[model samples]
Target: MKEDMYSIKMRAVRKEKHISGAERIISEKEIEVLVQQLTARALGHSKGKPDFINITIQNIGNQAIEYIAPLNIATITVDDYFKGRECAIKALQKSGLSCKTSQAILNMLKTCNTMRGAILLDIHSLERLEPDENRGVRVTNIDWSFKIKEDLEKALEKKGLNNNHVKEAVALASKVSNAPGIVAELCWSDDPDYTAGYVASKDVGYMRITKLKPLGDSTGGRVFCFDSSKTSIEECIEYLQKKVTLIHKIPMIKD
Candidate 1:
């Protein structure tokens, strides 16, 4: 393979509505750095392939740069990562991240990243986690709410859903108080005279929506929810065990 500096900038998009929250808010600049670093790792320049990392941010969407090594590159334990993930999720929840986002990020850290996957394999000696009837929510499969709009647009093209129907479906999906089944909708905005697109329930680690009408009212807003009272902690744990599959040897210690 050719070794050269290459940069790929992907527009930040939510794959689904989130409710739990993120361990860390990824700024655009930080994402750029992540892309660069991951690309470099892909070229075999770093300790390993791209894994989620932490960096101090100076700004959000505008001018921003990482102030420290990515969290994954730092000297820390997997237990620390799990704890940090929980912390981040809490922060995100406070900031209004939907539950799905939390699940997606955690999943990315545990199994999707190349290095994490290797470690997980060593620890678990398994390739994937099996989801049971009671455990329907799999972290690995949970859709990132932001990415949902783009994916839904594509899914629509393939006859998966239409605009109004999607809007309606997303509306209903968002209201689901339980595990918050995925929200997929087409929405419009009243501000700025012209704005419309698809938005899913927020999945920061909790779902925030409980009905479909709100989805139709906003162009871009919270798209998911998780009613703790309805969704029992025991069920969540069982779901986590069954749905949250690791790569193999990566050890996850809950704090």
Candidate 2:
């Protein structure tokens, strides 16, 4: 019998586009540290051969990215080490991570890093969450609006939404309205560009409440909520349930 380990390296490319109200914003590194720590716990160890991976950043392209794209995007370019049947891969799948964790990790890479930064590291690079920075948003509590819900259902009916999906979308709105990480903030800029719905934020590299205005605009009004910390399909589904347990602890956000 022989023991073997694979050492791999990956290059990640980041493209920044300074759009009207869509300029890229990176939140506190502590949030990122927390998120990465969670993901590392979920995927870093399992049953796998000694595996080493080094990830690097590349900003050779000046392409502008769509504000709403990262929310629904999930792509990963792994080296030959992850042969799909690797022990770690199987353990991750058994943990029900499948590709969801990878996607979240990749998505975090896309949003959390500096327009020009480096996250290239091996297992020693497990994510970390630092102390509080008093940067989380503060918002007032208001029940979700139903009229806006009706409007959304009618507007996207052709997309083939059913009662359940309608419930999810509407629930998503309600969750954001009450979630802890989200806040009802107004763009201080004279002519601010805001994204209407839920999308991943460069802040802490998680899907946070960026803009939240119900019954406003489908693209940029309110309605933003997602669980970017989740790594498995089950966790994604469980996010809605977790929202009910949300508690603002940053000590900065007001009630």
Q: Cα lDDT of model 2 overall?
A: 0.25
Q: In candidate 2, what are the lDDT values of residues 1-255, reduced to their tens digit? A: 322211111312212311111111112322344344333432332222123322322221222211111111111222332231132223323323335543333333223311211221111122321122121121111112222435544543534332332223233333332333322111111112322222222232212222222222222222122233423323333332322221211111111
Score candidate 2 by TM-score against the native: 0.20
Which whole-number lDDT from 0 to 100 does residue 28 have in model 1?
A: 46
| Tens digit per residue, CA lDDT, model 1, 155-215 | 4445433343233233222322223222221122211222222222343222222121222
What is the Cα-based lDDT of residue 177 in candidate 2? 28
lDDT of 1: 0.28
* Candidate 2: segments with Cα more than 4 A from true spot: 1-144, 173-255
Q: How many backbone clashes does candidate 2 have?
A: 10
- Supply candidate 2's per-residue lDDT for 191: 12
lDDT of each: 0.28, 0.25
